[model samples]
Target: MAESGQDQTKYLKGPDQIIPSDVLKTWEPMGAVKLKMTKSGVDANPPISVPSLLRRAADKFPDVKALCVKRDGAWKSITYREYFAKVCTLAKAFIKLGLERFHGVCILGFNSPEWFISDLAAIFAGGFACGIYTTNSPEACEHCAISSRAQIFVVENQKQLDKVLEIRERLPDLKAIIQYIGKPTSAGVLSWDDVMALGEKEPEEQLDYRLSCIAANQCCTLIFTSGTTGPPKGVMLSHDNMTWTAHANSVNIDFALGKEVVISFLPLSHVAAQMSDMYMCMYSGVSVYFAQPDALKGSLAATMKEVRPTVLLSVPRVWEKIYEKLMEVGKSTKGMKKSVATWAKSIGSEICERRQKQDFGKPVLYPIANKILFKKIKKALGLDRCKIFISAAAPISNEILRYFHSINVPLTEIYGMSESCGPHTVGVETAFKIGSCGRTPPGFYTKLLDKDKDGNGEICMNGRHISMGYLHMEGETHEAIDDEGWLHTGDIGHLDLDNFLFITGRIKELIVTAGGENVAPVIIEETLKGELPCIGNCMLIGDRRKFLSALLTMKTDMDMDTGEPMGTLQPLALDWCKSVGSQAKTTRDILEGPDEKVMRAIQAGIDRTNSKAISNAQRIQKWQILPKDFSIPGGELGPTMKVKRSFVAEKYSDIIERLYDV
Candidate 1:
């Protein structure tokens, strides 16, 4: 034992022996989520509040560029010190504006520095931060605001402000609205500058007190679900949930401190984007550049060329579009250019195949092909410095992955939901299988429950990164997380011999026919798209029905400005039409007045898909091509490009009825 005023470290055996008794006592558990702390787990996570993490970064890398925003054709950089100062000032402003503890500061905007500051400030002020999608309707925005009981709402521009104002009467808890972009047109609305000015008048004592009160186990943020099946549920994320996952991801991805760069474009409302763009970056001292608002609408490539991010996280649809555009451009190449490209692709494919089999040895001709072909392709796509390509939030087809690999770019798939803090299992470049979603990170555990004959079962995970619970929904929270503290992810998957998790389908999305045969629609739908080159989107339907049928949309040009599908077919679709000997130039031209050759070609593709079906009931007995492709604006797909099955079924009830009627 040490004397009262003596140094205690001299008596300790190791760092582990110096455990503070108050550390565990300080934990504040939420709902039914009890803290599960082990020496190793605590060592990995080191329970800390969000504000402390930001403070650590600021103290270590004060002069390092933390954020970059483009304005007047020039990039404006803000250092870590400046970022932290702004966050603290804004938090003081939030406290001055009467931000009640545990209430939300709802941010509705694209990915920007202001949005980032607002989110952190809310947590620092002892309030939870909630992100609202920019593409959400006024009603949808109101739903989120009400659910979170938002005290302050931050919008990007006048358009987003107008939405909140329209539903202002319904939002009783809303205390203020701040517009970050332009001058506010409405009365009582504060400009971004106004909020900063207000902070200058307030003292830091209140803010510091609030920050001290923050506990790692307390909910600091809310991630609203995309609501494909039903109403969106607010996912309550504790401070430890965000911080632990960020640290774990930093270790898993081998993030280089003060070196890695990334572009922020995906909706900040999403967990994947939030984790990568905000939490992960802050945790690893990575700098971030904000892309233009129209990044997803054809401007992403231009932004990519400018940023040249070290790591890129994109949805599968974006990857597919890039693949299609490259293939379309390749079709015009002739002579030696085309031959060298072909040779390079072959070499690239051979290397990728060997890499997948754990044989990373390069072929003899790889260097020659890489210099003449792969390097140029990577430079053109602005991925020259991109070391890691990640696909998440949706299932990416093996075709898309192979196509990327053929260009010397391999996409690694990450698997998780909002409930898991966006990353549970992640694919590493060295130890990854092409079709699998990699292995779980450190301090995380996964198990399959109620496995089928083939060993596929519902995937469940439990870890420090797991969410606290659903916000204010006790029944739903109990259903999602069992008494054993395992998050029962509705997603069905199987772990291979190497522990690579392969997602098969969702339990709710499974179609059980009247004859009692179960069918996973995703595999069937993917097979159809593989068979038909012209088909853009496919949805299989036969739930509680006699036989299976599919609804498909032909590949068509999308309006980059509006994100809507156009009547004209894409160049590849046209090439496909010509290959089948059809003269049709548009989907309407082929559908309104059916072409014999095109119909026969489609029939052939369907027959091929049917040949692979395990049972007659699993086969698509009929399919109808829609007039337009599925898009975000059309409400067929979510912001993450996930098809809303229930919404589609409700919208196309008559079309679905017609298929079964026959």
Candidate 2:
């Protein structure tokens, strides 16, 4: 023991330690769902929704910590008492603006307390909240605005308002644009203060009037998926459906609660980020920290050092970046550095194997490696005390998972669309399976319907989180939701004996080659993307042509000037991405000189991984590689960074036409 006057301090010397052992340790998987047996079985169907949660938590923990925002390079906190008052204020403002039961109000912005306040406000006013990606293209925004007939548009700043302004005239139902960050500078837009001005001056009585208007089954919000093939349609999520999964994932996992801290990074427009960032944090009375968009890394590191956050929510890309950086470090240093890296890779491989098998954290020989290498990695990312890492929005590579496991962090995979307001199948206290997305949460019924012996079929679910329906699209509503109340996810998946869900592909993205065999491009793309660090993402072409083909997007980590990885193993045939958005075709000619070795490696990874697939659809016979990664800012990926599949398919029509035309 130390002397009485001695100092005791904890250090974030390295990477975070998240125990996934409890979550995935049971070798038995349940095909689609494998929730651990609780004290009494979990309520398989829950009905209490999101607004009720807001109302309840507001009343119960009004004085508790709620939100912390980053401004001036530091954080400022807003207690739950303040949170409740603002939510009531915003809700009252919406009612005063002529919103009524079942009417539509849309919010387009990045992550913030304002987003949630607006949502609660809309729900309390007996209207639905529709959120559009703040990064959406003008056409995409117009389509959603018109279809939802959104009476109010809440925007974040000047850029978002610019987009809404470009096509504001086309959306006749558009009522007003409420700007949050600053005064509305755009013509025809209303400042947040102006809207607040519309609220009754008698604030206390106004809160009562707004609260009196809401009920249980009322439409809470309409979330739009950056749609694949058609106009963006709003998936109508009721308040109850919005809150069910939150409570379920919480109670079932015995979630770490109390005045804890959660770090919010991903765009809140997506559902997964909201589950952990907004819902879970509030329930636990945790202080939620919001990092600014531009200073994510610096702010994240600083915030974590300050907050020692319990949880971090993000998409696969961030994890992928971490892996790439670690690999770069391994490749960069010398002598002892090189030797330790080789040793670490070997040890890490073993760690991943044990992890995938759900028996990780076994006695290890890399105690020194943990002290020197892994700890450094954790400190840089500010994940020193991170309790759990929740990954969603895209399929994360097992390699990244293995990398994190080697360093001690474990990612809990959750599956859902914007329609659910978050997770349906999410990892709780249970350890994880390598490929499966984990078990469905309580209150949801999950099944792989119209599937074959392999259990591959449309992954469908009927749950408390099910959206009311697609707003204003009767045909799409009928198409998505069946009479039985199950939502046809249009995703093909299989269930193992233990109910762990392994999504095989998108049913809608299936390709039929000229040979008449159906192929799932995502299957091949995932396989290749898993191995090729240079490759950001790829799409398989030649759906009905002589042979399979593809267009590969290169990762931004590698330098365009030097074809090398700038760190790890570099790929073949890459440069198309660097030149695509260029004003000149002369610059676009860079793709003509792509590294053949990089191209072959991407092809090799695909062919080798597809050894299990039928030969006719296996290897990509011809390919075109890009020098740039698709991004939401680049008008490629959505705000959630999900591929706008049909948009990409349509945009590259001429290139795709030539591949199939041959």
Candidate 3:
């Protein structure tokens, strides 16, 4: 926990203010480090507001492709000028609808051009915009709208609108509902066209004045936490917080204006997408392509081939699938193709090892290997033009990172939270570390609080990118951010001498055995998955128990072509199960009624994991195969694909008790 140089006396309110001793101990001040590009005038003249960033892009790169979206089976482009104009019109429409400055307008939908436009319009109109997750239940949506004191709600279509309508009675402050597509099913609901028409009648001067009046310190967006532990909190990010992040990331990554292309598919509700796909693109003048909700599972490859984006941001699951597919491809190859693939992969591994050791001097075989092997692999994955591929939002397996890097993909992992306005630290390709999450970027300083014998502690951060605080939760806000402005990220990690961060696990996720031995479950879980490729999701359970146990799920129901679920076991998965002597013919049978042979295979994996455990207590004593994998729709995972540990534990408490009962 590091403190900034800002005056702390102003934060100490009330005459009887006695700060807790625990809080005082956590406030260890640390020195700030600047990004290399910052010294060379990279962020010398950063934009002050989101609207200003969009305006600057339109003014300087008017003819540049600002946005592309698939419509009528064709990709349609919107130039910077057109984007700015649309944003302005939307802003004017919000004004005409009587949206006052600093009022809240919530967008509930999937990621699309309309969603982005609506977000910018809110900012342009001096309104604080918030996004509700598409996977959220009606009750969850109600919570967000009520928490933000939303005055207006925007829905993508009938389904999203239905959720809002079901909870409309609970949101008394709500004044209007706008639907982006289709006819409004209820009276008082406005269509997208109707809003735009209203904007045409409103004076443009009003929108301009509102944008001008917006201050950098004013809150512009409310991003809710994933609510893995409890109800989601609205993280209030100021205009300055977002703008600084966009500028810092652009400069650090060396983004090329009007040249870099990106695909926007991650949920807009998350700050990661906001920072990388929206704000950074606006500031760096990068053309962004929007993908449909089903595109990732249906036409992601086709879209990627068409766009040939230079930057790709994705979650760990997507990368894992890609890695698995590559492995499957290798397994299915024969004869000369197989031999060539093996040789190429060996060369790739050699190059990766050399690069990790800082040996940039190329070996004579490297170029040949690249031409014959790596180049073709990259093209097949539609990543031939990709310069920066980022995996974030959740911890990715080191095995997956190594596989990609071996194939000439400079895949890197970043670390951050919604409270930090996206990423505070990112692995640069040149300085990438396999297991570490990279160094703290410019404008941010990190410190470890309450270190243990292993030097691991809660990772605390302080910076311009930090959010204002949770909306309307003063007590929780104080608990998260101290009086000195340091945000206490509950994640547990340690930094190396070079400032590279290695996240071990979350403090809340630590499992303590009955004997009082502490262990990080994620470490063991990741190890099991790495060793047993068939294991999709693993959860370790042993709090207040004699020994650790696990709940396992297999990656079975997936489409071979698109990596999308086909609602049954894939042929490859079935073959893998059978190869291990399983008689199961379906995903249900493999999981719910696993044969003795399948059980033996699972036990073998646990035995291998136990051999690597530090102590008997750390080893999993027993385990069970879950009938199904954790998913967002099932309420077992968050929108970001992170397992809701508490929820899953509670939902399967009977199964967990059965493990210990034996």
Best by lDDT: 1
Where in model 2 is the C-alpha error above 4 Å?
1-51, 169-175, 186-189, 193-200, 203-207, 295-308, 341-361, 364-369, 557-612, 660-662
Candidate 1 local lDDT, 289-309, one digit each (tens): 999998888889998899899
Better of 1 and 3 by TM-score: 1
For each candidate, C-alpha RMSD in Å? 5.1, 12.1, 6.1
Model 3 C-alpha lDDT per residue in residues 194-243, reported as the tens digit of each score: 98888878888888677656655546788988888789988888776788
How does candidate 3 score on lDDT? 0.80
69 in model 2: Cα distance from truth in Å? 1.2
lDDT of 1 at 588: 84
lDDT of every predicted structure (CA atoms): 0.86, 0.65, 0.80
Model 3 CA deviation exceeding 4 Å by range: 1-47, 558-567, 591-593
Tens-digit per-residue lDDT, 315-351, candidate 2: 7766766666566665557897777766765665666
Let me know the TM-score candidate 1 reaches against the reference structure. 0.95
Each model's TM-score?
0.95, 0.83, 0.91
What does the lDDT read for residue 517 in candidate 2? 76
Instruction: Give the count of colliding residue pairs in each prediction.
Output: 0, 36, 0
Flag the better candidate by TM-score, 1 or 2. Answer: 1
168: Cα error in model 3, Å = 1.8
